[model samples]
Target: MSHRQVMKVLSGLLLGMFVAILSSTVVSTALPRIVADLGGGQSAYTWVVTASLLSMTASTPLWGKLADLAGKKVLVQSAIVIFVLASAGAGLAQSTGVLIAFRAVQGIGVGGLVALAQVILASIVPPRERGRYSGYFGATFAVATVGGPLLGGVITDTPGLGWRWCFYVGVPFAVIALAVLQRTLRLPAARRPDVRVDWLGALLVAASVCLLLVWVTLAGDSYAWASWQTAAMVGGSVLLGLLFVRVEARAADPVMPLWLFRNRTIALSALASLFVGVAMFGSTVFLSQYFQLARGESPTTAGVMTIPMIAGLFASSTVSGLVITRTGRWKAWLVAGGTLVTAGLGLLGTMRYDTAYWQLAVYMGLLGTGIGMMMQNLVLATQNQVSAEQLGAASSSVTFFRSLGGAVGVSALGAALSGRVSHYVEEGMAAAGIPQSGAAGGGAIPDLGSLPGPVRQVIESSYGHGIADVHLYAAPLALVALLLVLAVREVPLGRRAVGE
Candidate 1:
């Protein structure tokens, strides 16, 4: 390809990626209002996010496989088209179910966008130069991470253009990405002879993941942890998981190669990605809610408060990527990132309704820096370890686990918050000489504006306490992640494309 053509393809890839990330991140700040407007409860809110994560996680390998079979350009454009349709459908949905179903569709598109972007980038950039461009990907990740909440908050708070616009807003950008890619992006095709998709493997993997997600989502809420529902979900998940392992081993082209797990580097990276996903996605998804409910910030203001986190992420990720490229050291950053994430979560666990804003900012910054250092480097380290042909499988596999971890964490944490909030609300109301009956409503906590000032303060305080507990509860998981990072052997950085 000509230099101009290469640049055009790269630009289109980045733009498509930005829109994909933007759609996911931007919904964070707007979720509370969106759920309320759609007449749903906390579980609905959790599902809204989980459904997307589930679809995204499950579809990633499929997209990668498709890219290997079909042409990259065709798959990427098709993903964008599907994403546009889903976004419009989600924006126009009248009910939570419709919104969730469409969001799932959108997630599938996001899966394609994410996986194929890496694939195409690898086709153009060499391993050494890839880091410099990986910096761009990191920046794009940070921007979308920051912009999603900020934009979501603004759209949610704005009159006559509420949370729905957050979904609608991406439609035009995705359309543009599709048109640009169609016109400008060209690449060598992966026309492997006798290529066939492993559809059964895909179905088994999806079923297994869905069962597991549902189990996590339902545990400690719809049933006791030891109840029949739990047993069924947990049992069914285990069975399907084993079945998937068997299927992958036997399939000519498995969605996930069972052999990939044998590589220590790939295994470690996947584990690290899982923890990072839990810490990064699980924590950030709830920040907007905490800021609005606990700190009493407006949605827009909540988005603004997150600047320290985004800034920390961008700075650390860029700096670390550069230093790793120069020095060929990566494992230390993984260990450090995990440690920082642990510390950040612990700091956040100390938060209260009246906690100083500066303190929160500091905690957020620490968390962001840790995540920045760890997330992409995990992929980088894995890429360095695997062969070129294994690139698609390895990359998609890491992404798949990371996303699955996020979905699991969100469901578990969301359920915890729901229960904790109920307990605190009850305690606060009783302490204030109000009837316990006042806290009996089974949906989302009512809007603070609707309550009397004193009652509202109590509600806010309860939410703050509950959110702090959520962080505290999740801290051990981050610490465990930190320990896992420590176990990863330091691997020298190589001149290998991530999707090698």
Candidate 2:
């Protein structure tokens, strides 16, 4: 395909990618409000996010493997359909349970969209020039990441439009993307008739991840961390995980091929991606809560406050990608990204509710820049090392680990945040001469507008300090990611496709 032709196909893919990201981000600012309205508490809040990540993580490898065995075009469209239906269901949900179920289903579609987009792009474009196009992905990500929150905030804040609009709003964009893809996007089919999907392997992996996440999310609040329940869940998860590995080792067509990890680049990149996911998604997902619950900002204002981070992400990804394309060098960007992310998280750890917006912005900007430089490049590095035949598995394997990290990180950190907030609120209440009974002390997300002044301050301070602690806990993980990236041997970008 010519540059123009590639661009045409890319437009549709980018739009699809936009909707997937938008689905997640758009709900971030609205979540506190959503959970409160739904009569949910902290555990519910964590599950709302964790449910999606868990499903996405579990399903990602399946989608990627299926893309290799089946045709890409139909699968992409099917994913779009699934996502749309799930979004509609989610919008109509009256309770947290129903909403969580719908969100998990939505993640199955997201897994496909996210994984297949990379596979299709790599299939169509050679690695040497892919950096330039991947930059477009970064731009689309920036736009959607920035736009979703702002859009969701406005919709949530607007009279007569409610939070449900956030879910509904993506439908039209998805429709347009589907039509555009039908018109412009074309990819050669790589269908195999004899290959069987390792359904049992996929199920085992999903079960393992689900059990571990549930355990982490519930341990401290629902039961003691060292209790029999903890032992049961942890032991169950480990057993399932072991079964998954054994099944994959013997399966004729594994959901995630075991041999891909033997490649030093893919292995190291996967490790880096896992830690990055933990550091990035785990911490940043709470920023909306920080702004709204801690700082007393309206959803709209909260969205606006996040612009600096997204802006930095946009700039770094675009510039780094362009530079990589021009010079065929990417290691420096990865290393620099690792450093910035670690620094950003550390700086963010120092924030209180009263921290200056400028300081927050600077910290956020650094983190965002680091994320931009590393995210796509990690996948790029893995993709560069694998053959065309193994492209889907290789790409998805890295993505799988990243999403796994995200799922674990969100669940674990959310639990930690809940505990920290409870502790802080209790301390604040005691210090203020208020009875513990006066506080909404069961890890419930309180409505700041309804609280008495002193109580609201305590709650705000609790969230502020709690969220900062989340970032602090995540920084060491980012540092680990940096170390992993340092160990990834840089391979020259090849002009020809792998196995060409």
Q: TM-scores, in order shown?
A: 0.95, 0.99
lDDT of 1 by residue, 370-424 (tens): 9888887777777666666666777788888888888888888888888888888
Residue lDDT tens for model 2, 18-83: 998998889989999999999899888888888888899999999999988998889988888899
The number of clashing residue pairs in model 1 is: 2
Flag regions of model 1 displaced more than 4 Å: 1-7, 440-442, 496-500
Index of the highest-TM-score prediction: 2
Give all candidates' CA lDDT scores.
Answer: 0.82, 0.91
Q: By TM-score, how accurate is candidate 1?
A: 0.95
How many residue pairs clash in all the candidates, one count each?
2, 0
Query: Model 2 clash pairs?
Result: none
Instruction: Tell how far residue 76 is off in model 2, in angstroms.
Output: 0.7
Q: Which candidate is the best by lDDT?
A: 2
